[model samples]
Target: MKKKIYNILSVCLFALLVSACYDDEGNYDYHEISTINTEGLEKSYTKTSYQDVLHLEPTVTATGGESDFEYLWTLNLTKGSGTTSNKIEIILDTIGTDRVLDFPVNIKQGFYDLTFRVTNKSNKLETYQVMSLSVVTKFSEGFYLLKDMGNSTDVDLHASDNSLVDNIFLKMDGEHMPDAPVSLGLDPGYCFVDETTAEYVITKALTVCTEKDVRISNIEDMSTIYTHSNMFLGGEAPEEKPYYVWRNAYGVGYISDKGAYFSTQASLWDLLGTGKFGFPAMVNDDEETKPNRNGVFASTCFYYLDELKGRFLFLDYNGSLHTYSDLDENNEEKPNKPNGITHHLKFFGKNYMDKKSTGYALFEDENTAGKHYIYQLVLGMDPFNPIEKVTEVATSSKLNGANLFAVNELTAKVMYFVNDNQLYMYDLVQNTEELLRPTDMATGEEITYISNRYWSGSDNADKNFDYLVFATRKDGKYKVYLYEILGGKPYGKPVRVLEGEGKVVKMHYVDPSMSMVSYSYFPNSF
Candidate 1:
């Protein structure tokens, strides 16, 4: 009986080995996947905006296939000049059997070919499905505003097309932000990080809000936000929150309470580790409450205020941080660095010129009389070298403080400044100052914020005339005044007084396509 059992076991082992060796043939026990089919495959899609989320979650049906299979959905966008095209790949991981797939359809306005490939594990055969997608502009004409509403901040949408939805953020998410009831700090700004991505920074505990193709589409989903608690190199704690956030080719940077920090992306927490650098804030010994955390300048090189040192400093991409004078002093050819005027600046006007010939407006120095000097900083042919041009523009009386609203790049000559009760236009070309308009400060009527419509044509009635929008408040209502600029001066009284809601504190003209204005308001007056 033992001998008979041994003979049977040996025969079975030999059969198993033969089957394993012949598994590559069609004789395998597992069912082979011959073909794959998907039902309701969308052949074409009409995308109006980058925010349009395409419902990719489609039922994938397969026939004549084994139980173990893999599904791959791929999308390729082709862009370039003529025959030379660059392919942007979008791939979803492999999955088993029939499943639903979901993804955003946020891409630049263009035509793309999408492909779906499925493979059977048993046979290693692939079945491909092809489709086409068409993306066009829908809400491309509008301006989006991030505003402070006393208790919290909210995003408002002003659309040129009446069909587009208004107050998009509240409508889409039913909340001000993903983190509701979060207040914002000074001067929140937005920048296009890439062809499809836009980053919005409100500076509440270092939260960066990201949006994809926000312009021409209704936000069908919730926004993704990133917050950084500690952002320091060598694992050190963050010293201060950013006051102003700006972006360029180098990356995003912030003028923080502690100084200046630059990051490759919105998540500042990992900035230092991911090839980022920072400049320390000027040390405060006398203990001043409010440092001039106003404006910032950035291009290939960055220039920012050093409050404690009471001067301006620039950081180059080569990781070199020095003052304009430091560059001169280092050069042996120029021995004594010019030191006649004090190197002090309270704020910088919004830079609106080309990087090669960029011009910046600087508030010269703070004084007891509250009288401040206005200086136009012009970059020479060599961007690293700069020349300071002092403007005779002076404030009427001792104006305590003012906000640099907008810079006119059309003529590269004028800028708008908003104080408590007046709006001043400083002509850099002629070095002249003019108070364009005034408000009654007694009845809570004061100019709170201003924004420039630097866009051309679009919805603007006069293509030649640029606009300066002023946010003035009285009682409980907010009024917006759009002043047309003829030549380089405010034409007259505001051409239009727009109806504004809430306590308008901040405003920005976001998009040129819609000629829409975005402004932030507070529930209560400041």
Candidate 2:
């Protein structure tokens, strides 16, 4: 018992001695914490674009503990209140790690918060600044407004959102747009082959023509795929720019001072085309028939004479200097009448009422140059002479002095034309002229251009609506009016009147759905 008590007391004494040695009243010293500051950062940035360089150089300052610092810059997409997954932040990327951030803005268009953080390495103290950043792309979707400004061209884009992106040619090409506009043609899609790799991609292609040049480009970004000389299979451009360029599902071809060149033949084995236009189609590749040049610039171009698919008959009214050729789907010529007397025709289009083989061309007799005779063709499957019968159009003074003609593509049910500042619609079936406006003539107000296009709305895959549009110039200013067609006459109120710069040469609506590789794919050689 005595030994146990001694052992326990000894253990307690050793524990107490150790605790007393460790416990001490000591004077402690404290060091100051490090701090960081960013003073030169802007509160927000606006008008930024894709492929733009986002320059961020904030003045940073750090004090106390070693003064060593680390930098970071991060981008996060700014989502709105009702956006999906409200709790999660979309961290786009860590754009930078240095004090000065010279980041190339490669992210798609969106509102974002750009953050810069500086950390004091010695004390682990951090400071950050967030700036509002917005990225925009004008090329996303829009109507390319090709305007004639006399000395130079202004290819502006009226965005689908109603925002105007002016002078897109200068903004994109870094050069002034060329002037003396020849033609601006649009195909559903074009396949461009890489000049070096021989690889190809189908894209939204647009043909632009000036007095000096003819070029094809991807309409989405206005990026050039082929220039003048490179557009032909011979590797030589036309000495004269094409006065008119035309394309359809059947072929892509152009008429220049030289002659006609076709880029595609629907019957050819290579439906994709050779990526360049070939020489004019020939009869057994022997005799060449250039388009009949009736007037300067071939004022009266060719038309599909019958309900036939690919046979274009260039009208020759004055003489038999030109002969009609029956081109098969292979674009090869066929025997005419088995007698060799090719028919010569002068075709005036009521080229409206589309979607079917409704061939409506007003045949111009040799004597009646200014008269209108509407002819709707009903013919055999192999129409040797498509014109079975003709309807003599009743004469009217309203048609007098009427110069411009616009056939509505709603299948030409009604055509719109202006006479002496007055707008009129001629019913092809009724064989009558109805004046849409009376006392419409006012001094200093003149109608400039008129046409029709198939348009439904933005992002519209099915172009269902047909609108008859016309432009008027008053007091040195121009405005275009759009009217929807219901039952052949312009229905209801004017859909919209667009005011633009200079003279509106053409308006091409950009469909976002056209950007896909296979969407509306056609054999447009480039």
Candidate 3:
């Protein structure tokens, strides 16, 4: 009986082993597998900025499996391109459950074609699917400006045209560079030091590229000196000089570390003191000697007024603007300040105006009247009569915080700060005030102050003009928004024209003739 029991137990063990084997084997009716599901073999991929990697996701399914199944994947580009076999593979029993396949490896940037195939235990083969994808190369070109504190450098390039031009560099010569460089009305053309030496200088080019024959002293002197700052023809004779007497032609306006300030008429190379205005009144102080009497009023803003001659403006930091008139009449040696020069104003705030100028000025009532006013100034007017104090258009309680105001010199339309986020426009001719609330513009729910710098295209050269540009912070980044000046005011939804990671430090329309724009960017950090 014991022997019989042992034999029975052995038989039972064999049966159990066979049962386990059956369970492990995939169960599918081969006869029923007449159709294979290639739909399960769908594959897709995504491309990234990374140059080398290729990512793939593939899904596979089969109608029936009589035995173990296997999958083979291959990648191919165009014809004649080599093929990668089994770049990815799976055994239906063990790894087949995974529908997504990830292939992480470096691949060239180009078009690629891929295919996947599968085979079952019966040796029946099937082409799963074919896919095509593209890998693009990444490259972009444009202009950029770099600023370090008061020192600023700009690089402009015509990438598509393959033309490289307009590179400007302004380095503060003193302790630190100011935020703005006022236009001293110095000519950026040929600067003459004395009647004999002539130096060709372009503002954009001088900032970066070095000229073969030019000397720094030559440029510096031309930039600072007025009388000798102009170019004389080959046959022109030098005027008899007590050279000192010639200096009276050009007046020195303001000087900063970026460069000396002289009338714009002075050639690019004239020396500073040689001009008519001489150097700005020198300040007498113990802490630090004021370089020029202009005194270091404020360092990071600019203001400009466009007049009949051209555009007259001053950089807040430099206290001067680029002037062509200074170049025509004034000789290099006798640099003369641009005529009709007026007082400079500086506004302070984080998003405060980076620059100011144009038909108006910000003034505070002295009577403790708690009223701030915008005054239209006559360009190049006698400083004493700088402002006829036109009309009391807009009033602001926070005069100290107001950084900028703009006037449509053509329309005589004034836009000023009623509050941080609220802007009001007064038509000088209409004598009507209109409120421009942030909520009205689809710039998000929160109302924020629009940028102080405002621009209207020449289309508005006529009273019915309609396009405008201004800076505003939205979605966490500062962007220049383009708005249509409908009916003489900022109206309608604003479209983003330019965007950058950094804040726009300053923006100047490249005059009305050209569609180009000159803007400065200050990085987030200092």
Q: What's the distance in Å from true for residue 71, model 1?
A: 20
Q: On residues 1-526, what C-alpha lDDT tens digit does candidate 3 reach at each position? A: 9999999999999999998888455866556543445554334443432444544444445556443556665665432111111221222322222234455434533335556665664657554666664443221122222212223323222222333333222222323222332211111122223435442222211111111111112222112222222322232323311101101122223333222333332221232222222332211211111121121111232323322222233332232333323333223322323334332323211221325323444434545344454544333322222333444434433433444444433333545444455556655445566666532344442222233333333343432223444555554444455566555466666633454332333332221111111122211000
Reference-based lDDT, residue 295, model 1: 49
lDDT of each: 0.45, 0.55, 0.34
**Model 3 stretches with alpha carbons more than 4 Å out:** 1-199, 203-260, 263-278, 281-358, 367-369, 380-403, 428-432, 437-467, 474-476, 491-496, 511-526
lDDT of candidate 2? 0.55
Candidate 1 pairs with clashing backbones:
49-216, 57-101, 139-216, 147-520
Per-model TM-score on C-alpha atoms: 0.55, 0.58, 0.36
The clash numbers for all candidates, in the given order, read 4, 5, 79
RMSD of each: 15.0, 12.9, 24.3
**lDDT computed for candidate 3:** 0.34
Candidate 2, residue 396: lDDT: 58
Deviation of model 1 at 295, angstroms = 3.2
Off by over 4 Å in 2: 1-137, 170-179, 196-198, 257-259, 265-274, 292-355, 362-369, 378-383, 391-397, 438-444, 456-464, 515-526
Residue-level lDDT tens digits of model 1 in 284-379 = 323222234554343444555556655555544333445555244234333222223444555565444433444554554544445565555543
lDDT of 1 at 109: 45
